[model samples]
Target: MNYEKYYPIVYKQLYYLVGNNELAEDLTQEVFIKYYNSKEQIEFLGAWLSKVAANIAFNYLRGEKRRIKREENILEEVNNIFSIEDEIFRSEQIKEVRKILVNIPDKQRVCLILKFSGYSYEEIHNATNIPLNNIGQFIARGKQKFVKLYKKEGEINVL
Candidate 1:
């Protein structure tokens, strides 16, 4: 089969759907390869090639749409997870707590910060390479130290 004659036409059709010269060229090559690999004897090679290229382009477009939609949904879900007011409140609370966090021992301070930043005990252990069993103890000690320091600071400021 003289497939070279159909290359330009197939490329033009694929380009219209994919809108990329390189991709259209690649798809056109793929179409010819599929046609050449066919076991059945084709009567009209041009028509068969055109039909196959159209089907490939259509399937590609459908899959692209689905992928774009899935990305959009993921972005929307991420945006919904944080609101402006929630962010502001969380920042202010963190600022207040950070004042007391400085007075705590380094290990306890780190564990407390990790816990407040939404890290689970296992996650903190993994990230810090600290033992899983020690994580809870660290967090408990951190919290107790934080409360004591906070009270002391508040009392000093009040006086």
Candidate 2:
């Protein structure tokens, strides 16, 4: 594959989706990395690359939205709290979520996280390299597993 020939095209497409040069550059690099790592031949290389670039950019944007919202929520919580005990309780809540996340398989874990992070099915598929048709199933199964584990552990619902 002629990477140099497609670099600008992919970069420009990513920049249009993300509206940031640095993020576009990073996503463009990620697209090429996927290309390099593919074990099978891509029939329509340019189109495939472009599609992947767009998906990655969209996924990044969705994840960013979730992150910003989470930060805002955390800020609000901190501002409203007056006790150190509350802060420690908040930290414990995060740990509980992490424990559930760890108990799931990689695909299920990623699908759940991406969904919770406000990503569309297409975006989750792109980020995890999972198939579009199976995104929902992965998410559903992930949630079921989390709930089962949560109940078994008897952990307080903090998320």
Candidate 3:
């Protein structure tokens, strides 16, 4: 049999299955090599080559799925580790800010902490029952006092 006659047919079949031209060409070559090396005679060469190509393509897809899953797991692990470190750093910064807040007046400290913790001015007013008009003033005064106290504690580059 002139195997050369079937090369293009087998390559096209593999390309359709694998969706990659280079990989299909490589697998087609491998299929022919396997056919040539086999001791058992194949009566239907095309059918045998198709089955072998399908199996090879299936195995390659399975391996690619496993590799992608492993990469995703590694990326997730790295992100989790970084998140933990960021949480710890944020905790330390919050602690330092809390210590400084203690030196400020009660109203100013409350307003500043609520603002830093991501509360809107209206929400802060509702929570603290401070007047809507005074909320801005409180936040401004609180920030000024916090900055002064933070500087006094020998901390440079506030925020």
Candidate 4:
């Protein structure tokens, strides 16, 4: 299997699906493993790989308790060690940002993140299932609200 050739392509696709860097990487690994395990049976390798990645990512999200437990374990390990002042400061700022983000409308925040994350208008429309004309308005409004909140409070509205 030419797994190396497909890794970058599949990883990028999976990133949009999961919205988390680390989880996307893990899903990429799982996708390749599925590919290797069923190499002989797959009639279309690319399609099979994508389907498997999507299914696994969806399953991962469906298992929210497992995700939370995994996060809790990682946090527990880190909390056992000494903490840096910068880490503390960053955590507090993150909390504040989350609070501010909660006040933002959901569509606006999603638009902002997708646009800022380098997605094209067409890509945004496709990913969000929104109309093409509405993409620009959503992004424009989202950015305006974000900038206003940032200037007013000196913090990002992110959650």
Q: TM-scores, in order shown?
A: 0.54, 0.51, 0.77, 0.39
| Candidate 1 per-residue C-alpha lDDT over 23-132 given as tens digits, one digit per residue, 9 for 90 to 100 | 88888888988987899999988889889999988888899899999999999888877676689889987887778888899888888889988999989998898899
Off by over 4 Å in 1: 84-159
Q: How accurate is candidate 3 locally (lDDT)?
A: 0.90
Kindly report which residue stretches of model 2 are placed more than 4 angstroms away from their true locations once superposed.
82-159
Each candidate: what lDDT?
0.88, 0.91, 0.90, 0.81
lDDT of 2: 0.91
Tens digit of lDDT per residue, candidate 2, span 27-117? Answer: 9999999999989889999999998998898899999999999999999888777567778888997898898789999999999998999
Output the worst ten-in-a-row residue range by lDDT, candidate 4.
150-159
Candidate 3 local lDDT, 1-159, one digit each (tens) = 667898998899899998999999999999898888999978988899989988988999899999999999999999999999999999988888778889999999899889988999999999999998999999999999988888877545543
Compose the digit string of candidate 4's lDDT tens values, residues 1-159.
Answer: 687888988898889988889889988998887776663777778887888888888887879768899999999778754366668888998886676666678888888788888999999889999888898898888778866776777633332
Better of 1 and 2 by TM-score: 1
Q: Following a full C-alpha superposition, what root-mean-square deviation does model 4 have from the true structure?
A: 23.8
Q: TM-score for model 3? A: 0.77
Candidate 4 has a TM-score of 0.39
